[model samples]
Target: MLLNGLKVVEFASYIAAPGAAGILADWGAQVIKVERPGGDAMRHVFADAKSELSGNPTFEMDNRGKRSVVLDISKPRGREALARLAAKADVFLTNVRASSLKKSGLDEPTLRKANPRLIYAMVTGYGLEGTEAETPGFDVTAFWARAGVAMMTTPKGHDPFLLRTGVGDHTTSLATVSAILAAVYEREHTGVGRLVQTSLLATGVYTVGSDLAVQLRFGRLASNKPRTAPFDPVANFYRSADDRWFVVNPRGGAVDWPVLTKVAGRPELTEDERFRTSRSRKDNSALLVAELDAAFGAMAFDEIARRLNEADLAWAPAQTPAEVAADPQLRAAGALVEVDDGSGRAHLSPAAPAVFPGLDPGVLPPCPALGRDTRKVLEEAGFSAADIEAMYDEGAAA
Candidate 1:
């Protein structure tokens, strides 16, 4: 609850920007999720299970634990209202395009002038001055496909594949939060705000650091399969008889090497020239893996699991989402939480992900429906009831 006193104003819609605000809210920031008069377009992204056209889990996921303010910032009065909110904010953020930011006067120069102590965080597909700046980009198009994600995920000659959800958007949002926190820390002493920016494309490229470095220096990178073996010999994922997967990287000082040797039942492997030293194992990784396959494949999953555990080698059965949801260790640690809404106790998926001193960061409320706090925020901002009504009449109350 250290963030209990932090104030955040968000001009965000989908997961990339609003999702970051949601995490801040979970840490106890008073995050105000701002949107257009009708609502964020993402509010209609996915219909609920009940009606194929009604519920939107997307909006619920990103805007949780925040107040909603409907102000049509495209309008002159709406822009003025939003600017007023920004002036008093500690952190202001948006995924809106650079052009939109300039048009609405929320660009760095304007916003910074309004609040010198405010941290301005911007999320976008491309950096502000790039040639691709004007093109619209989503997580899938900009981060996954155009970037090397499709290449990294699929084999050398296979068709490209997209991830099922917004991996890049969510990841970049967390990065943006870190940037904001750094700026906030600086502001505590200097009282000067700074602009922080991130892009899905850049983050995607940064993700493959080793590959990028290799390509940059050598002009190209060899695909995994083309280099002989894709698996890392003894350190990659392996499926057991029960379909449970286990991954381990046990070569270095594998004092537990005997455990693996015992599990392998190939006691001769210790003396085999191909498996003698770590360097030899890596060089002949493919051959060593074939030997392991022959050994482990002969045993039952339970037998092998028991042996691995007894051997004191690091190993675990593959767990699915359902299995992880019910994991005793995570539950005992209170990593998951159930919070109460006004109607019922709803299980909120995580926003803030770490624990401190055996305590959760904080509790997060469910996302507010659009405009749910318009009147209240207006009142807090000293807008008279008549003024609020007039603004609504003028199509400025989004």
Candidate 2:
């Protein structure tokens, strides 16, 4: 138990914030997630319609190994109870907006005064200051839409795809984790803690830092790697005769053109200067793509992949979510975990991405029912039974 003596209180939901807490849970931290009486909204997003316990797959994977307490902090006493928990916590993390923090009295200064050693982490939409700071945000709203990601990803004539899952949320979550770990490391020398923060928009911007720099430094959107810059005949996905897909990115230099031409049964193309070099091919990429497409159209995807593999060409079959779940490499690596799923049934899901040898890389707790750990958490906090009852009567706790 690496975190046997450490206690973490996470007042976050969805992807970005809870992701940091999930890391701690993986490392054996005694983490208690603070949710509202009805539970965090994420818990209900992907739940099976007929089974309440099904919860969101995103939440289940991110929140494993952490206990939950559904306490409303809307009232004075509720906030006071939360403060008490903070006083005992080694770390405090929240994804609520800055204004909301001030409103709830859970801001960093307030929590630091209660526990100087606390590693305070805050996650926001646009960051601590900006017009959008106080504005409401979601993963798509803050990360993909507002952060210039959509523009870069969208093909010229297509509606940009906002990722189906938590791309920015999970990315920013790793940022938060990196910050928290640094703060914890610094505590060893300073014997004090500091506030660490990250935002979905900020993280997305960082992910595309190189492109942003080019645009800012040169006053031009990138035209060197423009989408119209024809796809390399050898370095692209192709649909086979059977309508199955395979990506083949063999060596892209002129020297490697012979390898692909041989596969296409058109060795004469290697001698044609129009398709000889990469630069010339770029001038006629459509022709090259059409030629390769025709060649692939004559074979099954599996057969194409095999021939390309034997020819030392890099190739792989396009896989779906179901195929990904059963990937042989992933299974051998124990990256997917099996859970009872609280339905007298079992389901396998992806586990945390990294692992430490000799440590239990397992889920310590499953997603909880609303208020599932309310009584237990209160008792642990030294609240008497009558006092707890009084709190319920006052509508401060659930």
Candidate 3:
């Protein structure tokens, strides 16, 4: 319960913004999710999938342990209720477009006017000041397509593929959390909250900063090559006799060359002119990769693993999701946790990417049903029951 006393008012939908608040909730923050009537668009994602599953784990992952209050800020009463909630909150988070938020009087200036100590955090696709600032963007467009990730990741001459669901959004979510916490810390001294902004484009750029750095320095970057003709043959995947795949990344220079050569049962390769140095290996990568492929393919994965372990080589299996799900190390690393969904049951879900030794967040409460806490939250914000009922009657608050 590290953030036990913190209050986060989340006015966001989908992943990035809501996901940030989710991590805070995991650490014991009291999060109030202010959804528009009908709930977040994420609630319909599973329905769009046409799946037979009874639950929406994807939406639940980012919305768990929160109280929901439906409010249509397009109406005057809804905006009044939201402003009152913000007046007493520690943080206000959203991904609504800047123009729209300003129009609704929920922008930083408007909200901060009522509560100088409210932390206003926002997530955007491109950024806040660009010409396309108001342009609607999703992770696929801003993070992957516009940020050079898709180009750099796709192999030369290969068709580009979509990024796995929520990869970029969740990465942006973590960045937003980091920014929000930093602002929270700053508030301790300033006695005032600050505006914290994070964007998909920026996160995507940072994600591939190393590659971008090379491109920046050289004005160009080498296109990705297929595994067979990888730029570095020593760092490549190979198949075993049983057809299992594993990747190896041996040490640079001649340090691990002799060991690798011996382990491959081809000690002469260390002395071979084409494979003598790192540069030469790169120059003749395809040939070296072929040799390694043959050598590894001659032995079963178990035997290959033993030799690699004996040599202290760096290698790992290309594990499938099912394998990773059942991996004992995943639990040991605290990468997953069981969440109580208030259905008299607990389900396994991925944990936030960090751990506080003593502040362990064991089992979390369920994500609230849409508008389940509207009356309670409104009353906590100091609204009278009659006032809350009036707003509900007017379709302002539900």
Give the per-residue lDDT digits (tens) of candidate 2, residues 1-398.
66576788999887888888887777678888988777787887865477656356777778876888867789887888788888898889998877777888988898888799999888888888866678777779888888888887775556777677888888898888888889988998999988988888889888877888888898877432322334455577778999987776776466567888887667888878788878788788777787777887898877776777778877778889877877888856768766557655667777657766676554345666667787789889888899788778987788
**lDDT per prediction?**
0.77, 0.78, 0.91
lDDT of 1 by residue, 185-286 (tens): 999899899999888888788776678788889998876542224434656556666656676556566465555777768878876888777677777877
Q: What does candidate 3's lDDT look like per residue over 1-398, in tens digits?
A: 88989999999999999999999999889999999999999988888676676778899999999999999998999999998999999999999999898998989999999999999999999889969887787889999988989989998999999999899999999999999999999999999999999999999999989999999999999999999999888888899999899998888767888898888888899989999988999899999999998998899999989999999999999899998899998888889989997787998899999977866677888878899999999998999988998999999998
How displaced is residue 158 in candidate 3, in Å? 0.9
Candidate 3 to truth, TM = 0.97
Runs off by more than 4 Å, candidate 2: 1-4, 46-55, 223-231, 250-256, 263-265, 343-346, 357-364
Instruction: Please state every model's RMSD to the true fold in angstroms.
Output: 2.9, 2.8, 1.2
Give me the runs in candidate 3 sitting further than 4 Å from their true place.
none
Candidate whose lDDT is highest: 3
Task: Provide the lowest-lDDT 10-residue window in model 2.
Answer: 222-231
What are the per-model numbers of colliding residue pairs? 3, 0, 0
Ordered by TM-score, highest first, the candidates read 3, 2, 1
